[model samples]
Target chain A: MRIGLLKRHSAVFIVYVILAILILTTGLLSDVFLTFRNLENLLRQVAPLGFVSVGQTFAILTAGIDLSIGSVVSMTSVLTTGMIEGQQQLVLPVLVLVFGLAILIGFINGTIISKTGVHPLIVTLGMMSVVQGGILLYTKAPTGSVPISYDFVAWGNVWKIPFPILLFASVATIAIIFLRLTVFGRYVYATGGNEEVARLSGIKTGRVKTIVYMICSFTAALTGIMLASRMGMGDPLVGERYMLDSIIPVLIGGTRLTGGVGGVAGTIGGIFIFIILSNALNLLDVTAYWQWIVEGLVVIVSVSLYFRQKR
Target chain B: MQVAVSKRLQRSPQHIRSLFERFGIYIFLAILIVTASLVSPNFLKPQNLKDILNQSAALGMVAIGQTFVILIGGGGLDLSVASVMSTVAVIMAHNTEGQNSLFIPVMGVCLLFGIIVGFINGTLITKRKVQPFMATLGMMIIVQGIRFLYTKGMPKGEFPPIQRYLATGDIGSVPTSIISLAVMVIIALFVLRKTTFGRKVYAIGGNVNTARLCGYNIDFTIISVYMISGFMASIAGLYLAGWIGISDNWVGKGYELDSIAAVVMGGTTFEGGRGGVLGTIVGVLIVMMLYNIVLLLGMPVQMQFVVKGVVIILATSFYASFRRTQT
Candidate 1:
């Protein structure tokens, strides 16, 4: 009877099974696969994307998408590194200003989308171009570096655990609580589930949507800062993958891309699955080109499964 | 008879609105042209005009397909178009080995490949119940991966002269590409206006359940729309390869965005079932002109993105207000 109940909400369960199989296979195939050091490194590797996916969770929960999240991340990275300029004393102030700017961009995106009734995809795509172009115009190439002191956010650990993993866990925990416990979080799901019904029920659907998009962009900005700290330098092109990559895990985690039916728990499993898959491929020394094929197939199969499950 | 009478009775206000919507893009295009000529003497040069038209033809072709899909309106979009274009170009280059004789067979293969891709996309959306955006996006990724593997991350071969002639060759000073674009647009306009299929597309876009009750083959129509999109994308890919005389992985990198912006700017609401190829052509020209003006003003390329963003926002707001007033 308990197992039957578990099966009913077993999207996360299936993901765990797949993840375990992946880990087991990799552990058997490679000598270094199960090492604590390597596993820790993999967790750190997934952190930036993990953060962005959390943001996507909110946006998708609200029935809109932030295509500009990747661009915002890229721009944030550029601005952070540009402002920090390797000056240790400048990191804090510069980061504050960058975050402020990112939030402002998010606000503009939210306002335009909600007020004008423009499709979120188009609005965010336009914003993506603007941000990317602005970054390119500001620095034709990678131009500045963050201070070395900031490396702890990307690399350093407390009590043998990586800081990024710690950061991701806390953020995920907060997100879980916000989604499960808060009125506003429920409003987001309500808004996505049926905007008209939610509105008639006294929810400010527009505001909910705008705030969700803002949160999405804000997290993306945070990711950019982390990436900048990790690389020690900002490259204008680094965040391009986030546009698609961030959304993939959310979908794979059984969060409906159409919106309103899933949460962050599945996302964590999705992240682990992807990180482990990539790590296994790396261990197998698969060519990069073939890896693309594998990743694409995985997304297609998982999405097909999700659609079937929904039906 | 009652329906006809009501449509006739409602025609006056609708006529004025439709007239404005149809011709408004032309007015906007004319204004941009006048401004460009005034600001930059180079803009009026016959060669430059031809260059602009030639450049827009490829994008215009893709936008026509986008118009068809958007016209059907169940969140119909083919993000895979750009990826399809890139993969077709890579296949052509690899198969032809840059030999002029093999170009014809390779072109046939490209079209076949497009049909296969379109079939997959259409099937996924209709039969599998996948969202159009997600299905096409998945197709895009898959095609991109295929292209990468096929080219081994580095493509080789020069585009054939026969293909180049399609883009640059002229008949009585009119570029062949522009001429082909005009023919395609004419055929498209005729189909959308005069054919049963066109009516079905509009009917579906305007109201799916009603169309289904009225016995329209909704699934088939939707699939055909995607098929046309794939076909158009292949043609655009050929033009791009010929114009650039190279086969590269990112050949169609920005076409999906550019085509969407063009379709929207042409006054096709996201709600669908409105607008036509003429407006899309105007939209494409306007965007190309904007790029030209930015270049003439010696602005950096990055400014173009800002300009495009602002234009989209303003146009969308304008349409939103217009809809409000109408309501």
Candidate 2:
């Protein structure tokens, strides 16, 4: 059993080793790379990615991908600011409505996917278009401001640690526990491994699928809230990159694209790797265009690791 | 025997599904055109109608290329088409600088870029065991990065006057764009339906293991499909640039999704094999009509996107359900 556990965890262990090597090299590139200020900024950047990937972890563990999460985050960002409109009183109500809408979108995605047996990519791709269009129709340009009072979500520090890090840590901790110590989580694994077998065993696989989408989108909404707080305004395209970026961390952290294996524990290291690499590249005076090239290579390399690990 | 035949007729679910698969797009097209005409008189005008077809030719080319990739199955697609198109367009405009003489050289350069990008994507997927989605998406970012490096985030120059005229100029009442589209269609149709390579593609899409056991070169077939897709994207980039007549780095931003949507809507299953280019042309028309109607009605671009998304969901679900029944 101990050997089996080690075999299961070996992929994540490899990722952390990469992370350590990357940090050491990047830290040596410049004095500021290891500075407290730089690490705080890095944590803030990783926080939103962390939120989305946690939800992504749920979706992937069930052999599904939510392409619409980026749009969900985009909608949440705009709605959070547009409704709050620089006022404290509206924050609670606005968040309730935003999260409700996010859940509904997820529910719609889940229903079509489960009922029709259509590929999740196509369904969520459509949802992405619809939601993006809705945001544009609402306002083509970026609009809306956040109340300064809501800054705690993204900017506040607790016990000398940045609030974003704390929030991400808390969320990741809860998620890891839920997946590791829950019946529904086991059902997720079973469904991913073989839905026909799981269903034959009397598990409500459809419900599990729907709930995973909901959890995924709910976390996206949370990321949106954090982003809106950080940016101090709503931006329609802010979450545009999350669609692919979220998947990178999940894959890098050792989650299998084919599903039924891996967990969020690995994704934490993946997010850090992504943020640190990006941050380090910037610190090294790499141009944005070149950065994109490097980032592209990173996506392929990390994602391709899954296929190799299976072999 | 008579009783069995009659009983099968009574249980006509498969028959209904096949009918839906065969002519679903035609019905959808007719309805969309009728609705569009009713929405605005301008939609029916010869001039406006010509413009619609002319504009669709640009996107239609890209969609046809995507259909090839989609036909490869296992969720294979070229997400980098948009980036490829934009990069090619930028290269075309910048290199030509309004000179017709440079056209051949520019064409060669643009198509070559497409081939290289496609080769890289194919190699990643087949040789390195990378997922098609991620491989192409990564290639997309890499291409975009390269484009920005060349154009410096700002585009310069324009397509020569001859190219513009060729694009927008019509012969008598017919548009040149339509003629170009016909040539492309014939080429695509011939390659997909007539050639041995085409059959191999179908075999692979139907089942990779079976194809492999039969001694088909999986790597070569998949690589060539991507090559064809990339080559088409280059042609589309040039075609669209002639229409716009201006350089813009962001020209190809949304084509990937829109082209995939159009292809999927045209009765082509995403799982690959079993759909042809003719159906995809109709699907392109349906999407184009939607854009035209939205334009004629003064609807915002956002409305077009929403309608496209809703239609894709509706259309794909219809197909998906029928597919499930057959299985």
Candidate 3:
């Protein structure tokens, strides 16, 4: 029975194993790698990606991708900071406005994709273009500032553990429960597993797909807000990396691009794997160029290995 | 054959509907041209029209290849084309130094690199069971990284004499780039129209399992399709570098999504097997005109992207709904 359980979760085990090897190597190479201060910095730095990946997990779970996630983050960061402009009193209203825009973008993307039966990639890609253009029109350069008191989400610590980590944990925990315990979550799996079958089985696959995309943009917006607080300002391109990088963790987490498989448990590990690798690379004085190469190779190699192990 | 003819005759309603699929892009093009001319008097001038055609040559080449990849669709999109284009541009700009003698070897290396990238992409998807998006997206990142590392973050230089001649020089008062693109378009049209490989591409896209049962080599055809896409992207990069007269890593930056957008707007369904390169040329023209008109209007360059996105959504949704009605 134990062996059967192990066989089922072999992908998760492989991911964690890779993470262990990466951590060991990184710690051995950098004397400060395991230090509390550096680890905290790493967690804080990766908070944005952490939130983005959870949203992406939902989208990919439905066999759809959200290329607009990065741009949504970009627009939110820029808009939030642009509106906040160093005023503590304005933060609440601006954030509400920013998330509302995010929701609308998600709604349009989901509607076009589900109702029209168009590919999610194309819809999100179009949305990416629109948001990118809108951001550019709004500001060509980094603009606006946030009030100093608004840093608790990204910088402040509770019980010596950073607030970002706590926030990420809560968000990720919510995703895990939503996916594991809810009928809606099973509907996502069923939809992704086979949309035709899911439809015939009485699941509103279109609505499921739409809501998943909305969930994705919502988390991406959360990441954008945290990032704006962390940076105290917004750059139009600040969220650019989240687009592809968000998918990497999910892929490394053993989530198939084909969807209906994998979970958030593995994704959290995947996010750490990425953060630690980049952190180690920074400490080792390697040029940042190699990190992309390494990431690309890791994605291809890790996914292939998981596939083989499944067989 | 008589029964098939009768069935097709009975489906004349869809045939009339498919006219929209066939000529809808042209109608859209006419509207844009009219709007453009009304917005800017110079838009209808010969020089502006030629300029639009000239600009489209590079995207036209890449989009033709994108058409092939999208034609045989099982999530078979090549996200790596942009990086491939940029890598070629960087290489030519970094190495040429205006020396035409180095053209042969450099072109060979660029084309070879393109093939290697395509081979890696195809093998991963076909043999390793990796999804197409995952495999190609990884290649895109890797290629971009390799280019940047080789250039050490910045590449510098201009194209050789031949590329310059092609970029700005005219043959018989028509731009050489246009002629070059025209030649390729004719060849692509003929191949897609009359060749065995072309039929197989559509066949595979129509139904992979049925194609497999019919003894078609699914893996080989898919791989070849990617190779074609890579080759065309590299070719586009060369022309783009010359036309722009310099190289920046961002030169080929937006081509991947842009080419996909163009191909889709040309009435090619993502489900595949429905569009051809001939339609893609018209698609390329419409896209280029939008860019030119936006520039002519002195609008913020970003709105070009916004318009492109709007057009893509509208075209895809229209086609998608129409396709559903047909069935």
Candidate 4:
């Protein structure tokens, strides 16, 4: 029975093993890799994607993709910083506006997919284009600054841990619990596992999916805010790569791209693996160009591994 | 009496919906043309028409490639095509450097790269079982990175006059580019509509398992489809290099999405095996005209992106609804 269980859960098991191997390899390859400073910095850098991955986990859980996450991040970064403009007093209002816009975008995405039966990829692709254009129309150049007060969230530390890491941990914990221990979570799994069967089982599959999308955009918005805080400026192009980057972690961490077979714990491991891999590259003096090759190879290999495990 | 009239209107929407699928984009293209002529007297001039056709030729080639992959279905998409175009543009420009002696070799290399990339993409998806989206997406990222590394973020070189003439120069008052494009389209339509391979493509797209069961070499067919896509992208890249008179890393930035929009808008169902090359060309023409309209109206350049986005959403939704009704 135990052997059979291990066989079934082998993908997640492999991810953990991979994570461990990455840690050991990096540590042996670079003296600083095992140090607290490097670890903390890695966690801090992983924060934005960490949060985004949690939300992506939900979307993928429902057999849908959220391509607009990157655009949402871009829009949110622009909106938050553009509105704040270094004014501490406007931070709250700007955040509210950003989240509200994110929610609205999510609603539009979910409703259209649900009502029209158009594929989520196309719907989100359209949304990405609209948001991207909106960002350009709003400003051809990077505009506005994040308030200095917001630095606490981006750079602050508590109990020797950076706040972003703390934020990611908190979000991941709640998500893991929500997905593993709740009725709605099960519905999400059911919907993704087999939508037709889920519907016949009386699940409000549409609502479940719509809510999942909302969660996705909400987290992405939060990541954007965090990114703006870190950079202290709003740049339209900053979020262009996040959509691809976020999906990688989810896929590598054993969250099935086909949906219904993964969770937050696996995603956390995925994020760690990515962070360590990138850090290793940086430590080994790899240039930005070579990093791309390595990243692509990693995706191909990890995905292939996933398929092999399933077989 | 009011209910009867309302009922009649409601019933006509179904008629209207099908009409839109079959000819809506063409109608929109016509309306836009009329509107453009009314807005700017220069619009109907031969020079302007030539400019539009020239631009469409470059974009249309890419769309044809996109249509093929999407037609082959099974979540088929070629995200790397645009990136491949960019890389080839750089390679050709840098290697040839306006030297006629070097042109043939560079062209050969570019086409070779296209085939290699397409083969890799096909193998990754089919043999490795990576989702098509993920495979192409990974390739796109990797290729872009490689290009950046090769160019060091700055692309240099120019198209030789001979190449330039093919792209923009006219031959006896007829643009060679458009003529070439017309011939290519004719060839594509013939192959897609008349050949055994075309039938196999449709069979796999309509249902992959059924196609496999019917003894079609599913893997070979899919790989060939992507190879065609890659080759078409290389052609677009060459034309764009000549048309723009420069080679840059950013040249192919948005062609993937634009090609997808064109294919979907052309009534080629995303579910595949339902549309043809002729419709895609018309779709490309519609997109081309929309850009012209923006220029004529002097609208913010960004508004074109917005308009394109909205059009994609509306077009896809309309098609999906129509398909749903048919089923």
Candidate 5:
């Protein structure tokens, strides 16, 4: 009976095992992989994605997707970096701008999708192109840099823990609380699990969808700001890779693409597993081209395993 | 008197709707043509017209493929089509490097690859019960990786003589690429309108549950449609390779979006069911024409994306409004 229970819960167990394997492999393969500096750097690298995926979790919980998140990240990164442009005093205002734009973009996505009754994919796909174009037109070419002080958010430590990891943890905590304790959180699950029934039960389906989309865009924007600080420059193409990376981790974490389930905790583990694997691969001196192949294979296997377990 | 007035009001709205539905594509095409002509004197010239048609041929072929997948409902998207195209192009170029007689073998391999990829997509979605978006997105990433791995991150080899001839050589006054595009569109039209498989596809899209109850082989039909799409995508890639005289990794970057936009603009609803090849052809022409007009106007390449983005939004909104009024 205990063995059967263990088998049933093996998906979650797999994440821990993978993480342990990654650590052991990396420790054996490269001197740099186990270093505190490298660990800190990895945390900083994964932080922005962690933030974006948290918001993605909310949207996915409602059985929708936000392709526009990557674009939002790019736009915010550009706008914030361009605004701050070595002006130390302008950092706070730039941060505010990022937040405002995130909310506005999120609101628009939510409103248009929920009100028109269009599929989230098409709407978000269109918005992705629109925002990408907006960034391209706005930047003309990638040319802006933030001062070193802004990097404090990305690189600083709070009593030995990296600030970026701290940010990720805080965001994850808030998301968990929201999902567990709030009316909106329950509504998200209900809506995702069965939209028609939720509607029949007096849930404002449109409002719920809108809020979810808004949250996604908002999180993406925040991540964008942090990434800009980390990179110290705005590249129009910077966040393009995040769109797929963010989703892959969520899927790896056992979030059904069909939505209505999964949480931030599993997503965190998924992110850590991915980051460790990637870092280990890099440490082993794998070529970039081969890395892509390996990464893709990992996703395919992980997702197939996830489905197999579900069945 | 009251009945007469009410009937007239209803008839007028219906008239307007029909006009919008039937002539809207033509209107967009005319506007693009006029705008292109106004922007550049070279736009209306035969040479430029030939160039535009040749350029659009590949995109048009892919869009036709996309129309089939979208018509099957289930929010079916095939991002792997572009990657599949690249893979086929690479295989064709590599195997038929110099042998003129090896064209048949190359084409056969490309077709088999398409079938395999499409089968995987279909099986995963239908048998494993994966969402179409997730399945195809995974396939897209996988196919791209395979292509990159096979080529070692750089496209290798060269197109054989016959393949190059098919891409660039003309038949009388018509470009071979254009001819190929026309042939594909015709074949697709025939499949959509006259075949049992095609009818089943529409029925499934219209309502899967009803179609299943009616004893349609849902799995086979869905798989076949995706296979058709994958085959068309490879054909497009082959033509693309021939036309460009070189195959490259980035040959079909973001093409899935372009194909989807063309399909959507062609009046196929993303929700699926009612759409036709006739509209899709016009949609392809309109999109191609827009690109040409943007180029002619000397607008930056970025502007092309902006225009496409706006067109997609407008097209969907128009469709949504039209549906509301119709119901």
Candidate 6:
């Protein structure tokens, strides 16, 4: 019985082991890497991606991807920063507007995909471009700053835990519980596993898909707001990297491309594993060009192992 | 009435499908030309038409290769083709820098590299049974990384003079690139129409399980298709390098999406086994013309992406509806 449990949970086990190795190696290689300040910095750096990955887990578990997340992030950042722009009273309204926009984009993606039966890749690829363009055109590269009070809400630490990190943890916890204990979550997995079977079983497959997309976009918006607060500035190009980063953690978390399995806990581990590796490489003063190669190699190796294990 | 209806249905032979298919391509081309002309007066001008054709030439090459892969179906996607183009262009540029005699040798190297990358992609997808999306996505990342590393984030070197001429020179009011494109299209059309390998491609994409049962070399066809795609991608890269007169690490970025979009818009079903090079040429022209129209409207660069994205979805929806009615 114990061995069976171990076999089924091997993905998490592997992730933990990898994280441990990365942490230990980084500690040995650079004095700065193991310091409290550096650790705090790393936590903050990974916080936005952590939020995005939680949302991505929902979409990927439904056998769909959210390429619009990065653009959504950019849009939210620009919207929030532009609206508030040092006005403390407008912060709440800006957040609401950003979240609303996220939901709108998500619904659009879901509706178009489900109604048209077009592949998610094509749908989201189009959305990515559209959203990015929307943000750029609307903002017109205007420079703006977030209000200080909102920054406090976004960047303030409670007892040494950064607000963003705490937010990420709470979101992750909620996601894990939702997946493990909710019927909607089970439906999501079932739908991804076999769409026809799930539909025949009377699941509201369309609603489930639509909701997941909404959640993915919403989280992306939330992450963007947090990032805007952290940086105190809104830049159009800021969210460009999240599209790839979000997927890397989800893939590393052992989610099959065909979908239906994996959870946020494993994804958290995967996120840390990537963060630590990248952080360590930076600490070692690796060239930025070489760093890209190493990062790419790492993702390839992790995914290759995933396929090998599947076989 | 019943007898007449039955007779009409029966009289339409399988050959009718071919005729209908040919008609669809022509109709689509006509619609594209009319729409572009209606949208902008400058769209039909000879210079603009030549520009559209020149732009379409590179994308069309990549789309032709994409047609082969998609024809094989099985959720196959080649997202790394653009990255491969960038890498090949950089390699070719670096090797042939300021050397006239070395141009052909450098191009030979680029072609070989393209084949190797395509072979790896094929093996990973077929032999390893990786999902085509993930495999190609990973390869995309890897190649992009390698490109960045090779160029160290900055592009250096220049295209050979002869190579540059191939991209920029005009022959009797037609771009040299267009001539090259025409030759490639002819070769591709010949291969598709007259070769056994081409027949096998359609057969495999039409129904893989049946193709396997019939003892077709499924693996070989898949690999070769990817190899052909890679080779075409490299050639496109070389032309881009020559045309632009400079090579960058980011060259060909987002081109994979454009290529896939053109192929799908060309009436090639994502489900596979139902497209031709002729439709792809029309598709390429439509895409290039759309870009030119947007530029003519003086739209901002950012809005161009939005328009392009909307056009892709709209085109796919249009084709989807058209196909549904036919079936």
DockQ of each candidate relative to the true complex = 0.59, 0.71, 0.73, 0.64, 0.44, 0.52
Pairs with backbone N, CA or C atoms under 3 Å apart (clashes), candidate 2: none
Candidate 3 has which clashing residue pairs, if any? none
Compute each candidate's TM-score over C-alphas.
0.94, 0.95, 0.96, 0.94, 0.89, 0.92
| Model 6: fraction of the reference interface contacts it also forms | 0.45
Residue by residue across A1-311, what tens digits does model 6's lDDT show? 99888778777777787788888878988999988899888888777889899899988888888888998988888888887888888888778888998999999988877666666777787889889888888876745787678776476899979777888888899999898899988998998899889999999888888999999999899888887887787878788889768988888887766778777878999899888888898899987767766776676667667667667
Task: Evaluate fnat for each of the predicted models and list the values in order.
Answer: 0.48, 0.72, 0.69, 0.59, 0.31, 0.45
- Per residue, candidate 3 scores C-alpha lDDT tens digits across A81-138 of 8988988899888888889999889988998999988778888988898898899999
Evaluated at residue A31, the lDDT of candidate 2 is 88
Candidate 5 local Cα displacement, residue A307, angstroms: 2.9
First chain TM-score, candidate 2: 0.96
**Candidate 6's error at B173, in angstroms?**
2.4
Better of 2 and 4 by DockQ: 2
**Candidate 1 pairs with clashing backbones:** none
Give TM-score values for chain A, per-prediction: 0.96, 0.96, 0.98, 0.97, 0.94, 0.97
Stretches of model 3 off by over 4 angstroms after superposition: B1-13
| Candidate 1 wrong stretches, greater than 4 Å | A1-14, B1-27
Number of residue pairs clashing in candidate 1, backbone atoms closer than 3 angstroms, sequence gap of 3 or more or interchain? 0
The superposed Cα distance between candidate 6 and the true structure at residue B215, in angstroms, equals 3.0
lDDT tens digits by residue: candidate 1, B218-240: 99998998999999999889888
lDDT of 2 by residue, B145-203 (tens): 99999998889987987788778888887998899998999998998889989898888
lDDT (10s digit) by residue, model 4, range B1-327: 457555755777565555555666677667768888999887899988888898998789989988889999878889888899899999988888898878888888998888888888888888888877778888987888899899998999876778888988888888989998999999999889899899998898899999999999999998988888888998888888788888788777778878887887787776778788988898888777777777767889988777777767876786677666755
In terms of DockQ, which candidate is stronger, 2 or 3?
3
